[model samples]
Target: MKAIFLVPKDYKLTGGMYMPINHYVDYFNRNGMIVDEIIELPYHKDNTCKGISERLHSKLSEEKYNIVGFTLNICYMMLRDFQLHKNSNCDCTCFLVDSMSLNMDSVIRNESIGKEYIEHILKFFLYELKEKYCLRNCNKIVYVSSVDKQYVLKRFNRDILGDVFVVPNGIDLPNEVSDKLVRNENDIPTLGTLTGFSQETLNNNLYPFLYSIFPQIIKEFPDIRFVIAGRGASVEVEEKLSHLDNVDYIGEVEDLHDFYDKVDIVVTTVKKDCGLINRVLEAWAYRRLNIGFSKNFAAFEYAENGVHYLSADNEGEFVSAVEYAIKYPDKARIIRDNGYDLVKNKYSWGKSGEVFLDIIENK
Candidate 1:
């Protein structure tokens, strides 16, 4: 079998949509399907719609491929173009990283009304049209999580023409779990989290925790420290962090191993329920005790509340969870071990690849 992947021009090997797409390409090549080409479409550049359509059509028509895969996050226009100039015998599959409708809805509701908000509203309707087109035209739709799959189905009224499959995101596990330092009774405990620090993330995930939850946690464990690492900190974000005495705001971490090693507990502050939290998986892979809201963990159905990791919903619960982890280090270690085992056994690129390959071959 021969295949070709259509990806955004700005796609990288590690972040964003590239993670799953890279795994899928590797899996297909190893399993007798030759990935002959990975065509990078100039979606981000200022090209006319007709120009992009022509370029996509020309590239796709250059070779005869059994399968053509698309990363549907930002390439909705390409999908529409592909449908218009598709080969009758070739099959098409779309890989959705998350529900664009849900994400856009959240952004519009959260962001204040302004020029940016108007732009989002326009993009939201545009995405709606493209999403429906892809759903009605493609041969198969692949989702990173079941939560996203269900949301897309309900939003589109289950009017999809293609078969939908849930292929959860996987992690690249560390070679060995890092050794955590033994805490003396007088030593201060540390809590850590990482984010891109976008305006949306700051408002929805980090700022809420910093303002409402962290104060209560600080009241109980005054000696506890919070370590935050990620890029894109605006002046306002910097000012906000400066006011908090307990916060150690490291600008950006070059390697996550060091971040995981320094913290006693990993907290995922993402409030969105649409996609799988990579931090949760990373914490488990590094054998660190993770505390996150139950809703954030909803995408991974296999992860249990008390067995795998701690779950806290609101400020009071979150503060209490942090307090418990700090007080009873031994019990926290058990949860860390359990989470490590779950990730080791259930989450991997190979597993996700196998499922994707099965769907492609069987179809």
Candidate 2:
């Protein structure tokens, strides 16, 4: 048996799509499979679709693989070429990185964007057609969230329901969360939130929460520090938050290990989109208090409100959760401990690898 992962050029060994794909490679090698190669296909840098497609087609013809998995936004030509040359023994699978339809809806509804309505509608339709064709043709379609799997099933009338599957994101948990505990030893409790907000648009998911909810929380707890991770903070967003004295804007962290280590609690803001929340899982693995809405915990079946982690629906609730966590240290520790235990038991890479192997092998 053999399997190969066809990944995009931007895939990294850090979080996101790379984590699960890395686990899948381990699974294939451990379970008597000879295919441990991951082919990185370049993304469209030249803005010319035809040139990229030609290169992908040429690359596909060179590989002799049994099982090939496609990541997000894979070139149409690569898929078409694989379909053309696919043999009886070979299999094709796709991992829905995120809900494409839902993302398209977000773009269409975004007032800040400048694209014409008719243009967006046409692009939406074409994307749907391409996704449907890929899903119908693939041997298996893996979704990071059950919500996305159900959405795809409802959107497409094809008989691909049985072929679709859900494989929640996995993480590598440490034996103990000493770094978090050490951070908690500090006098001031720190809250961290990661986002990629740019100056060009307000379409970033972190905009609403940062603009609306964070200010209120800062007022309520003047002493508490708010750490902003990742790049793309708009000038407007920065100006809006500049008056706050306790905010720290640490831009573009290479790895979240050090970031998670320093933060006492993790704050996940409510966004327009819903899927696998990697930050929540990372916080759990690090044994930190993760506070977010109920939707953020949708992918984690074991997550319990105020137990495995805290949940907040509105600005008031978000403020209160932070207040409670800061004022009552014992309860916050309990929540963090429970989250750590939950991830240790259920979300390990070994278990995720086994599930992926079973799916790909059709066991």
Q: How do the residues 251-286 of candidate 1 rate in per-residue lDDT, one tens digit apiece?
A: 778888768877878888776657788888888888
TM-score per candidate, chains pooled: 0.89, 0.82
TM-score result, candidate 2: 0.82
Output the number of the lDDT-best candidate: 1
lDDT of 2 by residue, 5-62 (tens): 6677768844576777777777778787666467666543334545544544455466
lDDT for each candidate structure: 0.76, 0.69
Clashing residue pairs in candidate 1 (N, C-alpha, C atoms within 3 angstroms) = none
When summed lDDT is taken over every stretch of 10 residues in candidate 2, the lowest stretch is: 179-188
